[model samples]
Target: MRDYDEITAFLGEWGPYQKSVFFFLSLSVFPNGFCGLSIVFVGDIPEHRCFIPGNLNLSEAWMNRTIPLEQDKDKLQYSKCRRYRLDVIKNLSEIFPDPDSVNISEVGQEPCLDGWVYSKEQYISTIVSEWDLVCNNEWKGPFAMSIFFIGVLTGSFISGQLSDRFGRKLILYGTMGVQSVFSVLQIFSPNWELFCLLNFFVGLGQISNYVAAFVLGSELLGKSTRAIFGILGVCISFAIGYMTLPFVAYFIRNWRILLFTLSLSGLIYIPMWWFVPESPRWLLVKGKAKEAEAIFRHIAKKNGVTPPEVFFTDLELEDLKAKSKQSSTIIDLFKSPNIRAITIVNFLLWMIITSIYNGLSLNTSNLHGDDYLNCFFAGAIEVPAYIASWIFIQRFPRRLSLTGILFLGGVVFFFIQLIPSNLSIIATVLVMIGKFAVSCALAMVYVYTVELYPTIVRNMGIGTSTMASRLGSIISPYIFYLGIYYEFLPFILIGCVLILAASLVLLLPETINIPLPEMIDQMQKFKFISRRDHMNLDPLYTHAATEEDNTVTQKTEEI
Candidate 1:
C-alpha cells in the first residue's frame, strides 16, 4: 500500500500549500524561543545590598561602609546580605562627630532587616528586586526557573498523548492559548508564590505548543521540504525569536512590563488558526478519510493545482488505519537487549545535551560583560549552528559528527575557566562557541535518535528521550545555581558531563548511509557492521544491493 507521502506526491514539495504551512507553523514557534528563556532577564539579580535609610545622619564615608566588605569569590566586595549595625554606627557617629576619626571596623555585622537597595543602573526592576529574591532568598530565583522546567517535565509526558488522541492542531493552539493567558495572569501576581505557580502553567503550555507545531509540520509538509523545514524553518525562526528577547528586555527592564509586552505578542498569534488547517495526514490516520480528502482538496486549491477525483484508495486508507492501530508500550523498549541498550544511550545523550544547552543559556546572565549581549550572542550563534548541523547530518557520519561536536563543546567550556576574569569578552566568546557546539550536537542527536529506533517503538523511544531531556532541563537551573558557590563551578561541571557525553556517543552505531532499523532485532546494539551485512540480516529489508544482484542472477539462469 502507498504511504501518505507517496499518495500525496501530486501535491509537490514547496508548492504554495507547503510554503504556507512552513511559514505559519514556523512563526507559531517564534514565541517559544523567548518564552522558554524569558526567565533569564525576568529574574535577573541587579547589584544590591542592605538598604541604609536616609534618616541616618552619618557622614558619606560611614554610609558607604554600611555594607561590610567580605570575601566573595576571589575578591573583597560589599556584602549582599550583611551590614554594619546601623544603631551602633549611629552611636559612634554621635561620640565622634568627625566621621574620618571614627573607627567602626568592629561595629559588628547583621542581616539586612531593612530590606535591600537594588541598583537601578541596569534594570529598574526584576523579579529578584521586586520581591528581594537575593542573598538568603537567592535560591528562590533558580528554584522558580526549575519549577518552570518541572511543568515542562509534566507536559512532556502528556502533551504527545493528547495530541495523538485529540489531533495536532487542536493541542497546538490550545496550549498556545494556555501559555499566553497564563503569562498575562502572571503580571498580576501579588506575591512570589503565585508567580512561581503561574510559571508552571506557562512552562506547560510553552512546550506543548512547541512540540505540537513540530509534529504538525513534520506530518503536513512534503518529504523534500520537511528536512529544511525542520532544521532551518523551525529552528531559525526560534533563534530569531530568542534574539528578539534581549532587545525587548533591554528596553523594558521592569519584569511586569516585559511579561505584559511579550504576552500581548503571543495573543496576536491566536488569529493564525483561521488560515492553518489540521494536519491531513493525522486525519487520514484517525479514519477520517473524508475530512482528510477535503483538506487535500483545500491544499490543492491553495497551491493552484488540481487534485485527483478520488484522494485515497480504499487499500491506502486501510493501510493507514492499520498503521495507527499498531501500538507498542514502553515495556517494549526494555524487552530487547539491543533496544534497551540503544534506548539507554539515547536517554543519557538527550539528558546531557538538554541540561548543558539550557544551563549555558540560563547562565548567560552570570557571564562577564553586559547581560543582554551575552544572551543575544548565545542565541545568535545557534542559527548558524543549526544550519551547520543540517549540513553535517547530510554529509558526515552520525557518530563522528556528534562525538566531535560534543567533545569540542566540552573543551570550550573547560577553556572558559582558564581565561582570566579581566578578559570578559574572551570568556563570553568561548561560552558562545560552547553554545554553538551543543546546539549543533542537539540537532544531530534528534535525527540520529530517530534513525536508531524501529518504527513500532520509535514514538515511545523519542517520547522517553524527550522526557529525559525535560529532567535534564529541570536540573539545569540548580546546576547554574552552583555558580554562586564558585564562579566557574557550573562550567567545570558541564564540561565534565559533556566530555562524558562525548565518550558515550562512541557506543551507538552510526546511522549514516544505513537504512533505519524497522524491528528490534535489526538494531546494531553497540556495534557497527558493513551495510550489506547489516541489511542481509533483516528479512524484511529488500533494498540491499546484494538482494537485487541475487534476484538478477536467478532470473537470468531461469531464462
Candidate 2:
C-alpha cells in the first residue's frame, strides 16, 4: 500500500502538458461569456425619452444633449421637433449626420429596425417580452445566459453521478461530444425563441467541459501540480476570449457564423483523446482490481520503475470492514460531516463568481468600441493578472490572497460607479483593475474548492458547487437586464454579491502547503503560512510520472 501510494504520487510530474490540454479545453467552455459580450458589438446604444409635451425641440435636444442614440422615437413626437432635427443634421457625423450610419452599425442585427437601439436588459419582463426578433437585440440576450447556465448547473450536478457510475474519461468524452453538437447548433438558430432555446441546450453541453475536465485532470495528477493546473486551466480557458473576441469583433460579420466557426476548435481534442487515462482511483472503488493493477504496472514501467506485485494485491483487498457499514452512494454527500458545509460554501462561491464574470463580460457594451481596438486592449489585461496570480497563488495562502483578489474585484467594481465615462482614462484603469482582480478570484475559488474535497466525494462536491455557480449564472442575465433599464444597477448588484462571496471565503479554511485533505476531518488541520514559501509542495507530489502522462511528454520533447 505504501509503495502503491508512492508510485501513485508523481503520475504527472513531467510538465504541464495535461494542464495545457485542460487549459485549451477550458476555452471551448468559457468563450460563450465572451460571445455574450460581443453579441451587442454592432448594435446601437439606446436613448432615453422624457415624453414632455412642451416647446423643447426634442431632436435638437437629443442631438446636442448627450451622445446621439441609435434610435429615438419618444422624442420624435414633440410639437417643436423641427429645429431640433436641423442641428442634428448639421453635426450628422457626431450624431447620425448621414443616411448610412444605420447600415454601417447593422452587422449581426439585420433589417435595421427604424426606431430601436440596443442596451442591457436587467428586467426579466423586458428580456422575456420586448427584445425578440421584432428588435435587433434578438432572444439571445439575458435569456440565452439563463439557458446556458441552467445547462451548466444541471451538467455540473449530473456529471458526478455519471462518472461515479461509469468512469471519468468516458464521461468526459461523452460530455464533450454532446457539447460540440449543441454549440454548433446554437450559432444557426434563426428566431429569438429558437435561438434562446438553442442557447439553453448549448449551455447544457458546454458546462460538461467544466465538471469533467477538472475531475479528469485532478485524478491523473499529483497533489503538487493539481492547484497550479486547475488555476491555469481556468485562465487559459477564458484567455481565448481575448483572441477570439478581437477576431469576432473584427472579421466575423455575423454572430452565428462566428459561433459555428469557433465550435470547430473543439475537434482538436479528438486525436488527443488517445492518451488521457481513466481514473485508477475510480476503478479501484468499483472492485476492478485487475484493471487498476494493469494501469499501475503500465505507469511504473513507463517511469523506468516497477511496481512490486504486492502493491497490486494489497490495494485489491477491499476493506470489507469499511464496506460492511453502507454502500457509498452520491446521496451520502448531503448527510456527511463537515462535507455539507464545504459543499454549500463551494457552491455559493461559484455562483457569485460566474455571476460577476458573465455579467461583467457582457457589460462590454458600457466599455468603448470606437473600433475593435478596445476589445484587444481589454483582453490583453488578462495576461498580467494570470502572471500576477501565478506568482502569488502557490506562494500566498488561499485565504488571504483569494480574499484580497475577490475584495479587490468588488472594490474596482465599486469605483466604476464613481468614475463617469467622461473621465475615460480613470474609468479604463478602473475597469482593468476590476477585470484583473475578478480573474484572480475566479482561478483561486475553482482551484481551492477542488483541493478541499476528498477523493470519495470529489466529483460530487465539485458538481454541487458548480450547480450553485450555475444558479449565479442564471441570475446574471436578469441582473444585466436590469442594468439596461438603470445603467448602474447590474454593476452595483454584481459588486455587492462579489463582496459577499469574498467574505464567505474567509469562513472556509486554507489549503495551501497542507497535505491533500482526504477525509472531511483532515480539513480542520489547516495552518496559515507566509507568502514566500507557498510553492514548496510535499514530497508525495513528485513521486513518478504515470505512463499515460509521461508517454505524451516524452513524445513531445522528442519532437
Best by TM-score: 1
Off by over 4 Å in 1: 73-75, 528-559
Tens-digit lDDT track of model 1 for 185-222: 99999889999999999999998888898889999998
The estimated TM-scores of all candidates read: 0.93, 0.71
Query: Worst ten-residue run, lDDT, model 2?
Result: 75-84
- For candidate 2, lDDT tens digit of each residue in 1-559? 3433464754456444444445544544454435434444423233222222224334553434322234332223312111223333345435554445544322222232223332333211222233433233433555666776787777777777787788877877787777677767765555567766766666666666556666666666666666565666556555656546766546664455666666675676586566566777677667776787777677665665646755544533556223433334555455443555556677788878877776665566556444355556566666677767777776888878888888888877777768765676777677667877877777777668777776545656666776777788787766666754666666677679778988878877666655554443334322232222222133311233468544533442332
Top candidate when judged by lDDT against the true structure: 1
**TM-score of predicted structure 2:** 0.71
lDDT for 524 (candidate 1):
54
lDDT at residue 357 of model 2 (Cα atoms): 71
